[model samples]
Structures are given as structure tokens and as C-alpha cells.
Target: MADKSLNKTELVAKIAASTGQSQATVDAVLGGLFDALAESVGSGTKVSIPGWLSVERTSRAARTGRNPQTGATIQIPAGHSVKVSAGSKLKAAAK
Candidate 1:
């Protein structure tokens, strides 16, 4: 069976109706939430939206990597990665 889904337009419409706000306002709010999450992750801070998801920064150790095109060994510098973990409620809903 196909999974049920709602597109951004539908989601914004529903949120606008429920919150008594315009669709533009709903879009702005959603955009703000994503912007905040991104800013938090960029600053190496964890961001959690209750009943939704959590975003955190993780480090990758420096290692040797191979160049696919040239087949040459290369050194990769350690860096930070953004990790996202879904909330328990979201996991339950997926089932």
C-alpha cells in the first residue's frame, strides 16, 4: 500500500486553518523554524523540536581517502557533520 502524504501546500493550508493564520504566516513560521535549526547546528549546538526531531553536530576523525578518478591516496581533514535523529513520536507514527 502507498503511504499517506501531504505536500507543503496542503500542510501549510492545514496549519493556517488550525492556527487561524494566513498561509504566508504559516510559511514564515515554518521557514523560521528551519532557519533556527540550521543556525544552531552551524554554531555546534544541538537543536530539538519536541515530538519532531533533533539535530546535532558530530566530528569525523581525520583519515586517508582515495581519489576515485586518479586512484591516488589523499588525506582528509577532520570535520564536523550534522546528524539528525527523529523523535520517538515520529518513530512511532512511522510504524
Candidate 2:
């Protein structure tokens, strides 16, 4: 199976076409969505776009790991990472 792909321009065009809005408007709306996501993540808040996806933070406990190439033992400091989970509606739509 081949992977499907769509770029930002294609997405903007699709939104504009479907909403009968100007391309500029669609672009602005998309930009706002990205900005909101960034802000929410920065503030340590989960962002959920219903019928699309949810973005949240997950933590990793401190651990020891081996350096793959050098085979040297290293301590991996605990850290927080962002996780994105797809929503049920999106899963259904893709099927």
C-alpha cells in the first residue's frame, strides 16, 4: 500500500473550496489553529480538536540506556514529550 500525503497548500485549497471562502481566509484560519496549538502546548494544556485529534504531554522517567553506535552506557534524564492521538471520527473516516 502507498502512503497518502497532502501538504499545507493542498489543505488550504480544500478548505477554501469547501467553505466557499477566499484562500487568504482559509490560510488565516489554518494559521490560527497552529498558533492555538502551540500556545496550549506551551502552557502545559492538552489541546483536543473534536473529530480530529488530541495533543497532550507525556513524561518519561529517568533511565539508563546504551548508546547505540558506541555501545556506551548513558543516563537518559527524565523529560516531558508531546503526544498526538487521533480521534475516533478520523479513524472512521480513514477506513
Candidate 3:
């Protein structure tokens, strides 16, 4: 487990400080970035940042599942899901 986690506010503050921008501006930029990302990914388009991250939509097939409480079998419907991959730069930062 990590000792400390940075939330959205802290992240916006850090970015604002590093870029010499106001927190409000940084927050708006972040909001726009997320909105764009969601729009693109929701439309089945893959989003990639060369060395930082990639996100895409994936399809999950319908299948049988078990109900744990009743120990009964059930059918699970097909669904779409999002997959996020950390790119080389982000992976390197962890090392």
C-alpha cells in the first residue's frame, strides 16, 4: 500500500505550481482533458499519449456466472469496458 495518495486537488495544485498557472486554470484544463478523453473512449476510439498512457474501450462477451449467495448459475450480459495502460514513461517513473 502507498503511504500517501495524491487526489485531484493536490494534483491540480502541483501542476499549477510547476507550470506557473493558477489553480483554477489548471482545474479547467484537467476537466477538459477528462471530458475529451471520455468522449473519445466512449466512442470506441483508442487514446494514446506516446510515452505516458493509453486508454481504450473493450468488449466483454456474455457468459455464465455463479450467484455466490445462492450457489446458482446465472447468465451475464455482454458489456463494454475501459482499459487503461501505462506507457513507457509512466512505467519508468515507478522504477
**What would the per-residue lDDT of candidate 3 be over residues 1-95, giving only the tens digit for each residue?**
77999999999999999999999999999999999999999999999999999999999999999999998999999999999999999999989
> Tens digit of lDDT per residue, candidate 1, span 1-95?
55798988899999999999999999999899879988889999998878988999999999999999999999999999999999989989979
Model 2: what TM-score? 0.88
Top lDDT model: 3
lDDT of 1 at 65: 100
Backbone clash pairs for candidate 1 read none
What clash pairs does model 3 have?
Answer: none
Worst 10 residues of 1 by lDDT: 1-10
Flag clash pairs in model 2: none
Candidate 3 similarity to native, TM-score: 0.97
lDDT score for residue 50 of model 2 = 90
Candidate 1 lDDT score relative to the true structure:
0.93
Ranking by lDDT: 3, 1, 2
Best by TM-score: 3
Write down the lDDT of every candidate, Cα atoms only. Answer: 0.93, 0.92, 0.98
lDDT of 2 by residue, 1-95 (tens): 53988899999999899999999999998999999988888778999989889998778999999999999999999998999999989989879
